[model samples]
Target chain A: MNRRDFKIISEWIKKESTVLDLGCGDSTLLNYLVASKDINGYGLEKDIEKVQESIKKDISVIQADFNVGLEQYFENNFFDYAIMTQALQENKNPDRIILEMLRVAKEGIVTFPNMGFWKNRFQLGFLGRMPISKSLPNNWFDTPNIHLCTFEDFERLCRDLKIKIIEKKVLNNSYSTNFFLKLFPNLFGEIALYRFEKTN
Target chain B: MENKFDKKSVGIVVPKTAEIKHSLSLDCGKVLEKFSLVFETYGKLNKEKSNAILICHALSGDHHAAGYHSNDDKKPGWWDSCIGPGKPFDTNKFFIVSLNNLGGCMGSTGPNTTNIETGIEYGPDFPIVTVNDWVNSQKLLADFLEIEKWACVVGGSLGGMQALQWAISYPDKIKNSIIVAAAAKLSAQNIAFNEVARQAIITDPEFHDGHYNKFGVIPKRGLSIARMLGHITYLSDDSMRQKFGRDLREGKLHFGYDVDFQVESYLRYQAQAFVDRFDANTYLLMTKALDYFDPAKDHGGELFKAFKNTESKFLVISFTSDWRFSPAKSHEIVKALLKARKNVSYAEIEANQGHDAFLMPIPHYFNVLRNFMENL
Candidate 1:
C-alpha cells in the first residue's frame, strides 16, 4: 500500500460508498480509506493473523477461504466497489474471481504485475530464465503469482467478459508513469491498475 | 480492601446488590415486583461514563466475573483470564460491569429467593425466564448506575445469546457486541442435551418436586448427575483423552462400581463440588432460558431480518473444536450481519479445547479480542 497506488485507488473510489477489499492482507488500504474517504470498508482475508491485524486497525474483516467464492458471504451488488490490489495474479481462478467480484459489487478495481515488461521479456527470451524483477519479486516456482499476465492480456480478459474499462493506469515497479510507459504500456509497463464495470 | 493487588487481577472485591425500583414485566407474562440484581464492577466509570462495558454470563455463571472475594481465597472470578488490568476487557481502560442474570441463585432474585407477595421462597414457581427477560432486567441495572449507554456488551455461549439479544432489543444503547461461542437458537440436538440434564435432576427421588430445600434435603444425586453430563458436553473428546486417557485411577480396576478410570473419579469430584455450590431449581431455570433463546423467532425466522435495525458494530467469534456452539453457528451470525449490511468482524479460531475454549486464555483468541478492544 504505497502512497502512489493508494492515491490512484483513492481517486477512483467515491466517498461514503461501501467497499469490499478482496484478499486484503493487514487491511492497510481499507484503514486509509476509513480515515480519509470515510468509506464503509470491509476486508475479506483468509489468514487469521492478517485478519487479526486488520481488526486491530478497526477494519471490518471476514476470515474466509478465497477459492470457496463469495456467494455464501454476500448478496449480489451488495457493495459499491470491490477492490483487489496487487493480488489478482495470485488467485487460482482469476477469471471466475473477477466475475464474482463484479456480481457482488457494482464496480471492480484490480492491479497486477505485467509479465510482458521489457526486462521480463529480456530475461525470458534472451537469457532463457524466469524473470525476477522488482514487480514480480520471486522465483518462478516460489512465486504466489500463478496467473501473472500482461496489460494486453488483462484488457483482452475485460473485453471477453463484457467488462467496460473506466480507467487504466500503467506504472513502473516504483508505481510512477512516464511518456514512454504511457506510449507503450503493453511493452514497458511493469504493473497495471484498472477500474471496470459490467456492460449490461 | 485498600491493600496492594495483583496487576493481572481486578483484586479483592465484594459483590453489590442494586435495588430495582421499577417492576419488570417478564417475557413469560409474569411481573417481577421489586427485585434486586447482584453485580461486580471492575475499573472506574469515567467522567463521561463512556467506558462502561457489561459482561453477560452464561449458564452456571454468577456475579463473580473477575477478582477474588477475599485475600486468602484460592481462586479468582470465572472470567479472570480476560477482565483484569491490561487484559482483553482492560480494567484500566474500560469500566467493566458483570451481573448475575435474573433467575440465577448467586444472591440475585431467583427461585432460591423469597417471594414478596407470598411469604415463601419462589422455588419451582420462579416463572421460566428467557434471554429477553434478562436483557430488560439488565437495562434496569444500567439505569440504577446512571449510565447512558454501554461501550460494549460481551458474552460467550448463553451469555453470547444475551449479547445478540441486546443488539436486537436495544440497538442504540450498545456501541458494540462481542458474541463468542454462541448460537442464535439452539439446535435440536442442543435442546436434547438440556432436556437430558433436566431429567437427571427431576427424576431424583429426593428432588421432592423442586421443594427439596423446604424438606431439609437437597437433590445432591440429581444435581451432581446433571453437572457430570454438562461437564462432558463442555469438553472435546480429544481434550478429554489428553487430560484422562484409559489409565486406571489406581493403576488397576476396582472391578466393581468403585471408579474404574481417572475420568470417572474426576467427573464425580467435579460434579459433587458443583452440586454443593449450585441450586438445582436454578439449574432448571437456566437451562430453560438457554432453550428459549431465539432472537430470530420474532423476525419471521430470518436472523438477518432481526439484525436489520442494529446500529452497533459486531465481533463474533467461535472455536473450531467447539461442537456445542461451533464455527458453523458463528458463520450463521456473520452471514446474517452481512446480509443486513452491518459492519462485522468474524473470527473462527482454531482451538482444541471445545466449547470450554472460550473461557481459556488461548493466545490467538486473546490476541484478536485485545486488538478489537483496543480500537473500541
Candidate 2:
C-alpha cells in the first residue's frame, strides 16, 4: 500500500478513466488505481505466479506475452492511456510495441533507463564492456534488455513514427530533474519518462 | 476387494436406532404406497431438531451414502467423501437420511416391483412419476420420522434437479440447497441422447415390448449398448485417454471388431455388469422422467420467477469438462438465482472428470463443498 512506485503511479493517473498496464507484475499498481483513484484497470503479465497473485487480489489480468501483440483485446482508441513502466526495453520489438500502445490508447506513457547516461557512456567507452549500473542491473549474458536505447534515440524514433510528445520527465533515482532534464537530458538523466500521442 | 455379506438379509445393519424399519407408507390418495428408505445415522436427533440433512441420489444412484454392507462388494453410494463421520456434512452432528426414489430399481418400488392389482411386476405399466412425486414421497417419510425441516438438501445430477424442485415446491422445508451438475431444464441434445437410449432398448429383439419376462429373456445386448453410450457421456475425453488409450486387450490386436481395444473391452464389461442389477424398463422410465424435467416451464417460462419465493441459501457446482451438463448451464441457473436476489455460491471445478465428477473423490469438489457446508 505504501510502495514508492504505487504512490507515483497513483499521483500520475487521473480519476475514473480506462487504463491498461503492460507487464503489470502482480497488479499492485492496478489494484491501487482501482481502490484509490476509481479507475478501471486491467493488467497483462506473463509470469504465472504473478498472474495468480493478481487474481488473489481480485485484479483482472490476462496472462499473455504482450510482445506478440494485443490485437485481440484493444481496438483503436480503446484505452485512455497505456502505461509501460520499466518494461519497454524488455520486449522483443520495443518500437513496434510502443506503436501498438499508441494505436490502442489515446495516449501512451513509457518509462525506461537512459542508456546514454554519463556513467553508462563512461563504462562502455573506458571499460569496453556492457554497462551494469543501478538502473540496468544485469550482466551481459542473462540481461533482458536487448534493444536498450538512450533518451535522444527514443526522441528520434518518436519523430520518425510521427508521434508527438505531450510531456517528458527525467528522473535521477526517484527525484525528478526539473532544470537539468530540459537542458542536457541525454547525459544527466538516469531514467526517461515520456507521454506521447500518435499523430500518424 | 470384495466384502462378504448375507445376500438375503434384506437390510444392512446401521449404527443407530434401536430397531430400524425398512418401509414407510404414504397414501397417494387412492392407493397406500410404500417408500423404500435405507438410512444409516451416526448421531442422535435432538429435541426441537435443527440438525437434519436429507441426502438425495442422482440417476443410477441409491440410498447407501456411506459405509459398506457386510455382503455388498460395491463401495458406498456417491458423496461418501462429504457424508462420513468427520467430513464436511459430518454425520456426527447431523442426522443423515438417504432414500431410494419411487421408480428406482434398487430395492425400491420401481418397474421391478409387483403391482397389487395384477399380482405381476409393474414393469412398464407403472405410472410415470415426476420430481414432484418423488419429493412428495420424501415428505411422507419426513412426516413419519417426525422431522419438521431439514438443515440442508444436497444432491447431484438428477438429484440436483430434485433439490431445486424441493426449494421451489417447499421453500420452507430446507434451510440450504446444494445442486451439483444439474440444470433447470434438460437441453435438446440431452433429450436426444435419452431418445437414442430408449430406442436402443425397445429395438432389441428380446425386448418384446417390456414383456420379455414371459419368454424368459431380457434385452441384455440393447441395454448394454445403451449403458455403453451413456457411460461415454459420463466421462470426459481426457479421462478416457488417461484410463485406457489405444492399448490392446491382450498382447496383439484381434484384427476384427471383437473387443480388441482395452477401452472397448472395459465398456463391454461395464455394460454387461450393469444389466445384472438394473432393470431395462426402469431405465427407460427414469430417462424419460429426466427428459421431461422442466422446472422453468411450470412457472410460465420464467426460471427466476419459479425460485422467487425461495429463502434458502444455494450452492451450485459444475465441472469444467462435463459437456453433458456443462458449466454454461450452471451459469444459467446462477443467473436466474441471482435475478431472484438469493444468496448463491457457485464453483466450476477444474477437473478432467465429466458429469460423474460429483461422485468421484476430487479434492477441489471436496474443498468447495466442505467450505459451503461448514459456513452454513
Best by TM-score: 1
Q: Model 2 — TM-score against the truth?
A: 0.64
Candidate 2 i-RMS: 8.8
lDDT of 1 at A138: 98
Local error of candidate 1 at residue B212 (angstroms): 1.4
Give TM-scores for every candidate, taking all chains together and pairing residue i with residue i.
Answer: 0.96, 0.64
- What does candidate 1 score in Cα RMSD to the true structure? 1.7
lDDT tens readout by residue for model 2, B92-115:
667778877777877666777777
For model 1, residues B269-321, the per-residue Cα lDDT tens digits are 99989988899999999999999988888889999999999999999999999
Write down the C-alpha DockQ for each prediction. 0.80, 0.05
Which residue runs does candidate 1 get wrong by more than 4 Å?
B2-5
Fnat of all models, as shown: 0.78, 0.00
